[model samples]
Target: MASSNVTSFSHSTFVLIGIPGLEAAHVWIAFPLCSIYIITLLGNATILFIIKTEPSLHAPMYIFLSILAVIDLLLSTSTMPKMLTLLWFDSTVISFNACLVQMFLIHSLSAIESTILLAMAFDRFVAICHPLRHASILTNPLTAKITLMAVIRGALFFVPLPLLIKRLPFCRKNILTHSYCVHQDVMKLACGDTTPNIVYGLMAILMVMGVDSLLIFLSYVLILRAVLKLASRERLKAFNTCVSHLCAVLIFYIPLIGLSVIHRFGNRLAPTAHIIMGNVYLFVPPVLNPIVYGAKTKQIRRRIVRIRTEQKGKITGIYKNKQMIKW
Candidate 1:
C-alpha cells in the first residue's frame, strides 16, 4: 500500500512541477526578458547585415564576427521566447519532447559561440602578431572550413545530452523552476536516479567550455608574447586591437562561469542569481558584440556609415521620383 501511494504521489508531482508561477513577479520577469530578446535579435541581425553587405568588412575577423552574431541570434531565440510566454501568460507547460529540443539547441549554440570566440582569438593573433602571414593563413577556403568544423564540433558535443535527457524515465515531478528548459533544471524532476545525466552534463562542461576557454587563453598568451617582441608603439597597437575582443570574451565567459557556480554550489542563491546571470549570458554578447566589433573597428564603422548613407540616398531618390511622377 505504501509503495503504491509513493508511486501515485510521484506521478502527481510530475504533473504539477511545470505549472506557471502565480505572483506578479512572473509578469515582471517576462516583460524585461521580452524586451531583451527584441534588442538581442535586432542587434545581432544588424551586425550580420552590415557584415554581409560591406565589401571592406570581408576579412577573417568580420567573418568570425558574423558567425558569432549568428550563434547569438539562435541562442537567444532558443530560450527567450518560451521564457517570455511562460512569464507573461503563466504558461509554464513544456512537453517532454519540446523541453529536450530546447535543451539541445541551447547547448549547441552555446558550444558553437565558444568555439567561434576561439576562432576570433586566432584571427586576432594572426592579424596583430603575424600580419604578414594573416592572409595566407586565414584564406577564404580555410576560414570557411574552420567555421564548418566549429559548427560540427558544437553539434557533436551536445548531441548526447538531449538523448540522455529523453531517455530518462520521468515518472513525476516535472516542474522546472527558473524560466526555460535547462538540462540541470529538467533533470531535477526525474523520478529515476539522475547519476548518468549529471555525469554527462559535467563532462560536457569540462570538455566543451573548459577546453575551448583553455585554447582561447593559449592563443592570447602567444599573441601577447609575440606582441611584446615588437617595438613599443607597434606592441601598443597590437594590444589595442585585442581590447574589444578581450572585453567581449570577458563579458561572455564571466557570467557563464558565475551561473555555473551558482547552479552547482549555491542552490539557495541560484534563483535570483541564475535569472540575472542567465539574462546577462544570453543578451549581453548579442548586444555588445556588434558594438565591440562594429562600432570600435574603423573599417566596420566606415562601412556601416557608407551603407547607411547609400540607403538614405536610395530612399530619397525614390521619394523624389514619386513626387515628380505625381506632379
Candidate 2:
C-alpha cells in the first residue's frame, strides 16, 4: 500500500472546481463574487486613503484599522482574482507551484488579519481599561513592533505548510473542491501518508486561531469590566469605542469558525454546502470590515463624507464656471 502510494506528481497540475456543485451557476455567482471583490478593494482603499489624509484619525486605533484594511486588501486579492477568472473564463487548471503560492498567501495573510484583530482588541482594552496611559502604552514604536509581531507570527506559523504539502505525491487526485487552494483540501489528494500535514495544519490553526481568539475574548472581558465601573453615560461612551472593532472581530471569526466546523465534521454532506460556507468565510469579512468601521466610527465616516462633499463642491464650482463662460 505504501509502495503504491509513492506515485509522483511533482510535474503534475491541479484542477480547481471553482465552486464544485455551483459550476452551473458560475456566471450567476460571478455577479456577487465580483461585487465582493470590487467592494472589498474600493472600501479598504477608501479606508487607507482616509486614514492617511485625515489628521484626526492618526490615533492608535485608526492606525491599527489602517493596517487591517491593508491586510484585507491583500487577503482578498490573493484568492478573488483567480476565483473570478475561474468563474467567468473557466480557467481552472493551476500549476502546482501557483497553487502552493495561493495557499500560503491566503492562509498566512488571514492569520495576520486575525493577529491584527487581536492587536486591535488589545488596543481597545488599553484605551478603555487604562484610558490615561493609552498613548504611552501604545506608542508609535510599540505599534510598529506590534505590526512586526503580527507579520512574523503569521509568516512563521504557516511557513511550513506549503513546504509540507509540496512534498506529498498527488497521485490520488488534483481536483480541488473550492475555487482557490487550501492545505487541507490539497492534502486530501495526496496518496502518501498525510499525518504530518494534518498535524501541523491543526496545530497552526489551534495555535493561531485558538490563542488569538482567547486573548481577544479576554481583552473584551477586561474592557467590559472597565466599562461597568464607569457611570451609565460614560459606560455607553466607552462601550461605543469598541463597537466597530467588535463588529469586525465577529465578521471575521464567525465565518472562520463555520468553515472550520464544516471542513472537519461535514465531510458526509453535499459538497455544495461545504463550498458555500468556504466562500462565505472568505468573502464576508473583507466586504464588511470597511462598512462596519465607516458606520460605527465617527472620524472615518466624517472623512468619507467630507471627501464626497468636497467632490460635490468641485463639481458645482465647475458648473458655475461653465455658466460664467457661457455668459
Candidate 3:
C-alpha cells in the first residue's frame, strides 16, 4: 500500500509541461543545444585523437586536456540525452530511482570535473613556477594517481546523497519543478523536515566545490606572482596559455554557483532560466574547449592540419597506384 501510494504520488508530480513561450522558445532552445552537442562531440573527439596519435602532445598539459575531454563528454552525456528526450517526446516522467541515479551521476561528474580543473591548475603552477621540475612533478604515475583520486573522491562524496534520498519518505507532492532531477529539487518533495538533506547538500557543496575553487584560486595567484617576475615574453606566453582555461572555468563555475544560489534560496526567475542555465553549464565547455585550444595552441593546430593533409595524400596516392596498376 505504501509503495503504491509513493508510486502514484511520483507519477502525478512528474507530468510534463511544455514551455510557456511554446513552439518558438522550444525551437530556440533545441536548435542551439543540438548544434552545441554536435560541435562539442567533434571538438572533444578531435582533441582525444590528437593526444593519442601525436607523441608531442603527450605532455602533462595535453594529458590534462585529454582528461578534460573525457570529463566533458561524460558531463554532457549525463544531462543532455534526457533533456533532448524531453524536448523531443515532451515526456518528463522520470521514476524516483531513475531520478536518484541521474542526480548521482550529475553531481559526481561535476565534482570530478572541478577536482580535475584544480589538478590542471596545479600542473600550470608547476610548469610556470618550477619549469625544471615540470616533468618530474607531473609524471605519468602522479597524473594517473591524481586522476584516480579525483574519481574516487567524487564518487565517495556523492554516494551518501542517493542513499539519503532513497531513505526519505515521500510526501503528497513529489513533482520536481525543473526538467531534471537536481538534488535540491528532489529534496523539496520530502514529507518530513528536510533539514538534514539541506545541511548535507550545503556541506558537500562547500567542502568539495568550495575548497577546490579556493585551492585553484590560490594556485593561480602563485602562478601570477611567478609570471610577473619572469621575462615579459614568457609572462605573456604564460598568460595566453591560461586565458582559455580561465574562460572555461568562469563559464562553468558561474552558472553552477548561480544554480546553487537559486536552489538554496527561492527561484524568483522564470523556470526557463533554470533550464537555460543548466544547458549552458553542461554544453558550453565541450563546445568551447576545442575552439580555445585549437586557436590558442599553434602546435595543436599544425598537427591537426598535418594529420588531415597526410590522410588526404595517402588517399590520393592509393588511387594513383591503382590507376597505374590498371594501366
User: lDDT winner among the candidates?
Assistant: 2
Worst window of 10 by summed lDDT in candidate 1: 11-20
Cα error of candidate 2 at position 283, Å: 1.3
Q: Which prediction has the highest TM-score against the true structure?
A: 2
Q: Runs in model 2 with CA error above 4 Å?
A: 1-10
Query: What TM-score, to 2 decimals, does candidate 2 have?
Result: 0.95
lDDT per residue for candidate 1 within 1-327, as digits (tens), equals 012333443332322121233355677766666777787787778888888888877988888888888888888887777767666665656666777787788888888888888888999888877789999999999889989998999899888987887777776535555566678877886778789989988998889889989988999999989998999988888898888788888978998898788778887763555666766776677777777776677777787788789999999999999999999
Whole-structure CA lDDT of model 1: 0.77
Residue pairs clashing, model 1: 13-173, 14-172, 14-173, 14-174, 17-175, 18-175
TM-scores for all candidates: the values are: 0.87, 0.95, 0.89
Higher TM-score: candidate 1 or 3? 3
By lDDT, rank the candidates, best first: 2, 3, 1
lDDT score at residue 25, model 3, on the 0-100 scale: 63
**For model 1, how big is the CA root-mean-square deviation?**
4.3
- Angstrom error of the Cα, residue 20, model 1: value is 9.9
lDDT, candidate 2, 188-306, per-residue tens: 98889999999999999999988999999999889888899999999999999899999999998998998899889998989888888888888889989999999999888888898
